[model samples]
Target: MTSAAKPEADQTVSGQLRRALHPGGWSLRGRLLGQLVALVAVACVVMGVVTEVGLRTFLLDKLNGQLAGSIQRVDSPIGGDQGQLPLGPPTSGRLRFLGGGAGTAIVVIDNGTVTDAYTINQQNYGKPVKLPPDALAAMETVQVGKRPSTVDLGGSLGAHQVIAVASDRTPGRVLIVGLSVVDINSTLLSTGLIMLGVALIAVLLTALAGELIIRYTLTPLRRVAATASRVAELPLERGEVALSVRVADRDTNPRTEVGQVGSALNRMLGHIANALAVRHASEMRVRKFVADASHELRTPLAAIRGYAELTRRSGDKVPPDIARAMDRVESESIRMTALVEDLLLLARLDAGRPLRRQPVDLTQLAVDSVSDAHVAGPDHKWRITVPDIPVIVPGDEPRLRQVLANLLANARTHTPTGTTVEVAIAQLDTGEVRISVTDDGPGIPPSLLPEVFERFARGDSSRSRAAGSTGLGLSIVAAVVTAHRGNVTVTSRPGHTEFAVHIPSED
Candidate 1:
């Protein structure tokens, strides 16, 4: 590799390693398992490297000692002066004097020229084998008096640990001794393979055991999550809610990490339940107050209307202003009575007072409501579309009729004269009877669409109070529809506004 390319390669390898250690989008459990495995792998690699290095060092030291002994025996006076043999073919006699075991190579050099070179043939029971010229030439590079050196003498001699020394008997003669390190290399290879296999087995066992332990430890957290999910699915926004869901008792022990979380969650749920109970109690009290106040005001309002009418017609000619004042009083009393009735009805619906349920034909109800709207607002165009067959739904007849009447009244009061108002009733394929009131006037403002059915929700410009809009008509429609187990929705844009109600069919 070129020098400039080396950094790029190193960066690539480092990036790969970093990504493997901290992969993106890993879940908590996956990250934990990966860290555990990576730790074990690093420890195993370190152990293998240390074991191989230490074993090679010990083996090499022992081989060097054997090399020293071979040099002592070959250079001994018992063999011959200068340990020099005849400059001829290597013989068994020379092999016996070398003393080192098989696979030892020795060379005799005289005055910078090789005189004899041979190695012991281990396959032939320690017989001497003459070294090739190339192998002898490779050994000649070992420096004289050096401690030790490793030389690769190619062609079956392989690598050898060699040392050279000058002759004491002859001034110019040199002795070079080498021993094959093939056995050391083979031993190291075998040990490495064994260590690798054992490390892999250990890692596999650790992974399995760690996974089991983690899953068992997280079981309580899973249960806590399931409980929270169930609670989330409950209808806790309205009415009297029974917030009964809670973490299991064993899971909320507070002794473990997940247990601590579970305990805190249970405490939070308990507080919310208490708050919901309090809110429901407060709402009930308010509803009762409104219902009682409305019931009590009926008698006094009736008396006021009766007295004003009686005073206006007492068989005596009265001033025009006084008569007109009596007329205003009667009209206001009538409007106030209607407002009280609406409030009482809303209170009863909030208290879950059961309504009379019977199969009512929605087609007939739509026609009647549209007819009443036409009579009330004769300047506006009114249209009704209903199926030839009566589409019946199980609900309170009076309440359903009131729902249609309010929807039509809302369109008539808000739209300009001559604006078309349509009433449509049909049975849907989903076993629902749908009633829709659509108008082609200046549609409701987009800001008011969300809370159009809320109590006292009215537009400021187009739907003014001068139109006798108390802002409770739509609220009454919503309450009555909800009491009958139906849904109401409205959509409005420039030039179009629609109110749709869907009630489940009896069938």
Candidate 2:
């Protein structure tokens, strides 16, 4: 994405993230479970560090004590032929320890030159190794009856702590003993590696267990969310809102946080449902009043119009103003009758009354409606297009005729007198009929196109009361089409406006 699109993509990703997480801003369950696993991992790491340190300390202490004891045990027998001593217990079965463990080294130097050196590691045999100059120099610092001093034996003998003691048999000689500590370090390093591997495995297993347990514990919360989502899809905006949806029984317990939310939502829905009931009842009463009032007014309105016409035609030398006033009265009564009829039709449709269903020749109906439009809007150019074959549909012929006439009359009345209005009827191969009324005129305002078919939706103010328009023509058209299981849509932009209706075709 470019810099401009990056923010849009980021917003999309963020929205997806929010939808994936719980209502608590992020993944509450995962966060809680992860913290629990982290606690276990920290404890494991601390234990590993402590155990490693303690084990190394204990091993080193034991090695140091064994080295000191080995120093005391190394002695040459009096008058022996060589540097030989009586054999000790040899507790180490595999190690030829004259007095110490496998990997033990014993070195004895008298005056400036080394007199003896022996080493053993994992076998019941001792081998001699030459001492380097560094070992000689370091050992030269130790004195008899002094504490054993630790020093590096520098070359391949590794490092050691050496002790110098006076020889018990030889009169003029001093005994030097050195012990190597390489085995102690090697053992500690190997054991620490094992502990580290075990710790990592333990942490992984703990995380897995924690995730499973947390998800299982949060099952009721998931059900609560599901119930809310299902309820959100309901169409409760108008009419009687039968909000019968509720949280599942398994998730309705008020002892938990999720349960509390579910209970609150249920209470809110109940209140909204009650309010919707009251509103729907009020609307029904208003519709009933309009229908009854409109029905009762018809007879009086007709009688008044008849009397006004009779008085105008009385030919008893009535004044010109009185005659014109009578004509106006008759004209207004006719307009009122039309308005009342439209309202009664709308009220019936709203009450879900069924429309007349029968086979009607749509092509013939279109021809007749267009002819009537041409006569009514003689100043405007009108055209109609239909196939030669008869097009039939199941509908009320009079109502369907009214739907088409309303569409054409709406275009003619709203547009300039010379604007061309074209009505085209086509039967699609998909078993539907499409009828469109298009005009070349100043189009509907962009803001009003969305609600043009709504009752009393007015525009231009000039057409508000002109030509006896009730502002309900288009609404009645939409209602009649919808009753026949059809749909109507309009698109209007400058200089072009089209209204299309589609209905199922008959065989």
Clashes of 1: 0
lDDT of each: 0.84, 0.76
Candidate 1: give its CA RMSD in angstroms.
Answer: 8.5
Candidate 1 weakest lDDT stretch, 10 residues = 1-10
Which residue pairs in model 2 clash with each other? none
Model 1: per-residue Cα lDDT at residue 255: 81
Error of 2 at 457 (Å): 1.5
The most accurate candidate by lDDT is: 1
Each prediction's total of clashing residue pairs, residues at least 3 apart in sequence or on different chains, is: 0, 0
Task: Name the top TM-score candidate.
Answer: 1
Off by over 4 Å in 2: 1-43, 57-128, 131-215, 429-431
The all-Cα superposition gives candidate 2 an RMSD in Å to the true structure of 6.7
- Please identify model 1 stretches exceeding 4 Å from their true place: 1-28, 77-111, 116-159, 162-176, 304-332, 461-463
